[model samples]
Target: MRLRAMVHRHHVLGPGRVPALGFLALLATVLLAGCTSQGGAENSLARPLMQGSTAPRAMSPVERLANDLAMADVAFENGDAKALANHLQSVDLAGATPSDANGEAKLNAWRSSIAAAPPAMRGRVLGPAYLSGILAAGSRINTEQVLLGGKAVSIAAGTAPRDTLRLRIVRGDGKIVCEKSPAHARECRFVPTYTQRFRIELYNTGPEDARYHLVFD
Candidate 1:
């Protein structure tokens, strides 16, 4: 799949916040391992350009998260593993605070889709373990872990467009809130009312690496 259009936004100082405004369009093609990206291409796409500010402002927490998260989205969709890792190196894991032992969780999904392919391809799929959760700062897919993170994170597995991208979103410690399995049916997942840690596992249930563009907010 090819990302026909990607609008990269500027890190603007909004009314007490930073808002990420953009859109995505997908064009299916023979999956490319990754595409050649231009330097500073993302900066040029920033919309609602800004002018003058008296002081250089440090990014707000949400703004910072959005920034790193945005970069991660691009790198992942582009099928650039190293780029994905570098873009998210700044995100601290403090947000994943553990919930109470008795806390209750909620789950919601419009539909569910899991792929069913030949069993022979199983070896190609279950190959990586996102070692240090959230595709950690130094996580290496070639070694052991190659996990991706964000409000929405996906890693497509398979040579063909039949990407069996299995996703599992687990909350702080041992709490499993939402689980979406197989195929290009991207899981919209959940927006938990409570604050907690999230760990995602990408199982490649296809014959080769799957590739697809993701629209992450």
Candidate 2:
């Protein structure tokens, strides 16, 4: 997907907190693997846009988790309130609190911000995780655990020649959230870009090449 389109979607979607949480939930399932270097330790889609640097750093597991989690944080701040609330319904508030009062305050603020999200976005918040979870449950798919930076990143295996599978994320009522696209986070199993349409790419990450297509949609 074009970066501009992603920016537009970011705006239209309201509080991105839910999507960010969805991203985190996915990560939780795969947090065993350390980080991988896409560009560098601090590389994120936002960094270059801010500093105008193209240099890539090898991301440590810690850095990748921080970046992904931070991306969700930014999204939550900008997203609608109602969706944020619904999303928070599933979160463990006790777990969110930090030992320090300052940390607790920050967590509380995050919770409040989500509660302030608009009603329209409430149902859409869980779409990404719901869709992905459903896919994981329905298939006898392989899940890989890798460390990126230091955080565990889990990726569901794509058989034979493919290493990735793209999924269209949608609300239970069938609203398009995002499409699977090339711009998705490297560790993401489903890219949220092609909402109404989906394309699954299975890579032969293994040495020997294999081929298969359209056995199932």
Candidate 3:
């Protein structure tokens, strides 16, 4: 199978007194691997845009993550509560202290900012895992089955610090379409041909406990 097209994007939280540099590095390593040459893109349609004098240079994964966090900080400082929430979520606090006093203060502040918003808005702003302090780590397995329906599919997965994650997709014909083993602090994405059934597998191989989230569309 060939990758026809692919896009990589992330929903990250603001850098609120958390050790963000380490997290940014982790995301950068993972997303950058997929961005560069993960799917054998010698003839792939989704190539990186050329940097010309008239065109702005592309931001590397690290730069992009840093920019997102910086923007989130700016939004928070400007009292753009919704914008802040849009950028800051539970994922951003993956390896940090979400139950400590400082963490609780930050969570409460965010909740108060959106307390008057509509119920749906509130739900979206503060995700179900907000302040829950759930961490991903150790060896774990998660399987998901999906129907391709002749449409292109993209799967992106990432783990926290000191975590390694691997993904494999098996087709209805018992064919392995895509596989990725992202070592510690790596993010991965894959695009596979349409198939009747796709069995997606996620594996954690890190010594320390880690958490991961997957985005499939």
Count of clashing pairs, candidate 1? 6
Candidate 1: clashing pairs of residues: 125-204, 156-210, 157-210, 158-208, 158-209, 158-210
Q: Compose the digit string of candidate 1's lDDT tens values, residues 73-162.
A: 455556665655554443323131112221111000000111221122222322211111122222212221223343333322211233
Model 3 C-alpha lDDT per residue in residues 1-217, reported as the tens digit of each score? 1332222211133344256788888899999898777566863545444432365666433223323333444555589877766655433432222424544565456556753532332323321121112234445454555655556555544334323666577776778777767622222334445546677666666666544434343
List, residue by residue over 54-105, the lDDT tens digit for candidate 2.
Answer: 5786753222332333343444556755544543442332112132454345
lDDT of each: 0.34, 0.36, 0.48
Candidate 1 residues lying further than 4 Å off, grouped into runs, are 1-160, 212-215
Badly placed stretches (over 4 Å) of model 2 are 1-72, 114-217
Q: Sorted by lDDT, highest first, which candidate order results? A: 3, 2, 1
Error of 2 at 165 (Å): 26
True-vs-predicted CA distance for residue 166, candidate 2, Å: 27
Clashes of each: 6, 55, 7
